[model samples]
Target: MSNLTSHEVIILGGGISGLSTAWFLRQKGISFKLFEKQSETGGVIASEYIEGSVMDFGPNSLRDRNGQIRKIAKDLGISDDLIGISEAFKTRYIVRDGKLQSLSPNISSLISTKVLSASGKIRLLKEPFIEAGSGEDESIGEFLERRIGKEAVDYLADPIFSGIYAGDIYRMSKKSVLPKLAEFEQDYGSVSWGAIRSKKEKREVKPMVLSFKKGIQQLTDAITEKISDHITYDEVLSLKKSDSGFEVATEEATYHSLNVISCIPAYNLGRILEGFEPELSAELMNIDYAPMLSVQLTFNKAEIDFITEGFGFLVPRKERIRLLGAIWKSSIFPELTNKDQHQFTLMIGGAHDRGILTEPKEQVEQEGIREFCRLMQFDARPSVIRSRLWKKAIPQFEVGYEQQKAKLDRFEGGNPGLYFGGNYQWGVSVPDCIQGAEGLAEELAAGL
Candidate 1:
């Protein structure tokens, strides 16, 4: 007889999505065992303190767009550690004409901004007057080009969304990547009008870009602290539909549960469920993940030549640059650095540059530094340089994602006690993961 454990629910994976789901499910009085492959939790939310510098090996900042993450942190009793971005350093920049240019949220800023030419700015201004596009599935690049112009798509849409998804704008679905703008065209017949009306209806909540004083791992560690006993450090080998609910086999033992919530990545989850739900498994495998290289570099404050105000800049693919963009980590949260130390987390490899991940680390780092310095026209080498490679970092929301999502929904509905929730279908952010957890928690609570 195999070593077997039983529970009311079985949660797979130990990333933020899984932990958050487990946290909420437990609140609803659910009995579940969360099986994580890694010995420690926090999955990609890795943070470290080394050589007098605190750094997040994965996501450095968390955007509390829906305020869910903030509340979750407070509930976890780590609210006091939340460090908000410095108000003075909130300005965003983009590369244009081989120089860093300020990028404000206001569309009106385009009038005086050098990021776009007169023709491009005029084209952007005429967005309100442009007729709504045909309600059809379209790529973000195609959608923006139709509404604004090709110039805006290349300069604005390409780099901005690239920074987020690290994906090809021409392949990313507008409905999936940015559903709100797509909805604006469908409902209000004008993107600008929909934005204005939505703002008027809902109170303006400035989304906070924050990180923990210790690092992003604080929230994950705190979650694990509360539910430590319930988590099992074992890889789920496979899951199958069973008479009672589902049979989950792990490296250590076979666990039986009345319900199952899968929070694993699509790529891995597909393999685990392949023997059970082949069709859904096939769909899950269809999703694409972007490779990323997280390169952290620092310099002494006096060596920096350029203005270090606001957020960092994103490099557009059109510029023939290998780097995606970078963020000023020290500027955002002063606690992460030594006194007067300038730190930046530069990004390389994405949908476009998958090959860079396979190259020699020294060569790639050297090239990245050279390009970055030339672009900024600054003359200082980083005193501290650290690099981490993520093979499949973020899932790409490509065209036809809705169908892929619908298939999963069908699987969940067809199998009463089985469910799927993660950053794959829904948006990929700390807040999005939390939001998915809240929804799944309610769903499991009501159903079970």
Candidate 2:
């Protein structure tokens, strides 16, 4: 066996979380090494250029509500390359009665919008009267159904969260997944009232969905550039606690570190902790992941009859469509495609249709394309078709998530110099992952 290499801190998984954490540690002048199983970094963040169109295989864009994301971009020297979506893309669509319906962007339009029925809108008026309940965590569907109505849960919350997590809202925990909403309920006894009060308390900022000139991968690339030297391409086979700290064995060599931070998925981390922390491993192993597939297709502009407007439409389960949603990439970012072509990214196979992930890739693509054509009223064959399947995509914050969180807390407390930070810990968004990394880096730096 090769002699064990040593580092002050070791990061497992070279995804955005790992790369961003390494960048922050380097900024603090802390010593660390990042190990990735894959040959290249970025994990699922992949940008592909086909002919003249640029397609993002993973996340299309990020919501930068706070300036932290912009500061990171500036630090990476890629702020100049940051591109914000057009104001015209503010509108979002949802499938209703097998047709695309635009959601109102303003209060007046919301009252008049056909997305929800008159009875549903009237039910929303009684939201402030709904009594808040105190108890264990509830599913997002259950919470929304109680606060608003079943109509809202079916029409609004379902499609929106499906687009975000590709998860089943009925199984996802309300407090764990949507903490802000839960806080609103707890603070004011009504989500609607709390939202209004909170909005008045805070200054309004224009919402921006941002990406790089090339793609979201630019953010990962810039971070990797800063910390490339400290990265090792190897799969972590096992992790065991030692007297000094922890020893991590990878395919290439074993490494010793005073502190170990895991940026990998929950299931992968569970495998590494099997013998060392069986209880924690059991909890981690129970974390459910939803399978998702992103299908990118290009068509000649003249071949499509429907106008590609706003972002795109999300398919509510009521629509009984195999597709979860589709993002109009060319419309959102004009630079992503050639002037003569339009690009669309269709998402398929969430918790509702996980079996799609097991089917042949060709069948999945065909089904997605068929749904896309049916939804958009297009008949012309796509000029280009490509697909990427993530068997374990987004982690589900299912019922009893608080128990798992408690387990993580206990494990962290019991095992010193061990930390866990990833999309699974905080959130599934790009900004959320970056923020978690920043916080973890600060904690580790402070301890050092």
Candidate 3:
């Protein structure tokens, strides 16, 4: 058998995390090859252009203050193409009493919005007196209920969770998912005080929040152009110990590298490393993920109501709606839609709604359309249904997340050439993924 040559580093999985990792490695003048399972580089950042309108399958827009993502774009020479969400419509909404309601538009609005009950607002006043918990980890639901009362958790907080994680907040680990809140409790002894202190802390540094001028995929496309020939679309069939380093086998050939970064999701990691690292793989397999299906729809701009002029709205579980939320793509970024046609995107079925995604596609599509019409009060049905299903799209940071983190720590300590990073490893956000990539690159380079 002919021998394959080796590179200084090999990146597994072609998603943003892996691509970002390779992006930094390239800047460091290090030799590396990136392998993606699919032919494309962007994993969940897939965007579709229909009728001159932009539609997103995942991550419609990233926050503007994401310094790491923004810097990466600058390095890629696409910073000028980035755009911020319409400042006039940055506020989001939540569903309550089977109707779309505007959330607090301002600090003053918090006291006026009908989204929260009178008792709920009064209960929040007690936050300064509520004591913090002494524990390794706590669920997000528990934390909110203890601090602000169940109404805040159910209406204000839970709807936000529905949009972000699609996982129930009652089971999400506060320490893992929302570390800042956890830190707030630790330092100030009360969340209300923490918020007050946080304002002063934030004042010290100006935070920039925005998204790309084109779609987010533009950044990845630029990265791919830079490192075009170096990466391959070979799926890793198995991992094995080699004389010099490690070997990864694809269907057609085997590739060797001195160092490997496994950027694949936890579920995929479980499969590829099951034999090479059984115990570690088992622990990784236990990290439950949820499916996210997005339905992108296009409409006539004139048909939309004036109320639908914002980022969109999130539906809490109590609403009993199939969709988690809808993005007013046209309102937030009109470039995503044509001037004549209004563009909107909606998401449904997360870890909490596994049962929904498990059903047939036709059913999911119909359910999504029904929910969109009912919640957004669309004048007409969607002209097109570009439904995309992400099986095991994001990892759920359940209550026992620290134990899983501990297991990953031990696994990484033992495996020198292997590295893991993504939304699964860190908090689920564009900034977090970028931070995870940079951190992983430093770790792998140090080991080498």
What's the best-to-worst order under lDDT?
2, 1, 3
Task: Tell me the tens digit of each residue's lDDT in model 3 across 1-448.
Answer: 2144566687888888888888888887778888898988999888777878877788888864537667778888898888777764657788888887776457677887778899988997788888878856878999889989999888888888878888889899998887877888889888778777877754433456556666878877888899987788878887766876788887778888768888888888888888788887788888888888888888766666655456788888877777888888888887667778877788888877887556997798788888788777766866667888888787899998888888887776676676777778866776677778888777766755
Candidate 3: segments with Cα more than 4 A from true spot: 1-7, 202-205, 446-448
Two-way lDDT contest, 1 vs 3, winner? 1
Candidate 1 residue 134 C-alpha distance from true site, Å: 1.7
TM-score ranking, best first: 2, 1, 3
Predicted model with the maximum TM-score? 2
The TM-score values for the models, in the order shown, are 0.96, 0.97, 0.94
lDDT of 1 by residue, 1-448 (tens): 2434455678888999999999998888887788899889987788877656777878888888767788888888899999888864557888887888887777566677788899998898788888988889989998999888999888988998888889999999988988999999889887888889888776356688888978999999999999999898989889998876789888877877778888999988999988997887787887999988888887887887756676788988988889898887776777788776777888889999988768987888888888888877778988888888888999999889888888888888888888887889557787788888889899878875
User: Number of clashes in every candidate structure?
Assistant: 1, 0, 7
C-alpha positional error of residue 164 in candidate 2 after TM-score superposition, expressed in Å: 0.6
* Per-model C-alpha RMSD: 1.7, 1.6, 2.0
lDDT of each: 0.84, 0.87, 0.79
Ten-residue stretch with the least lDDT total in model 1 = 1-10
After superposition, the stretches of candidate 1 with alpha carbons farther than 4 Å from their true spots are 1-7, 204-206
Quote model 1's TM-score: 0.96
Q: Which residue pairs in candidate 3 collide?
A: 64-208, 64-209, 64-210, 65-208, 65-209, 82-213, 83-213
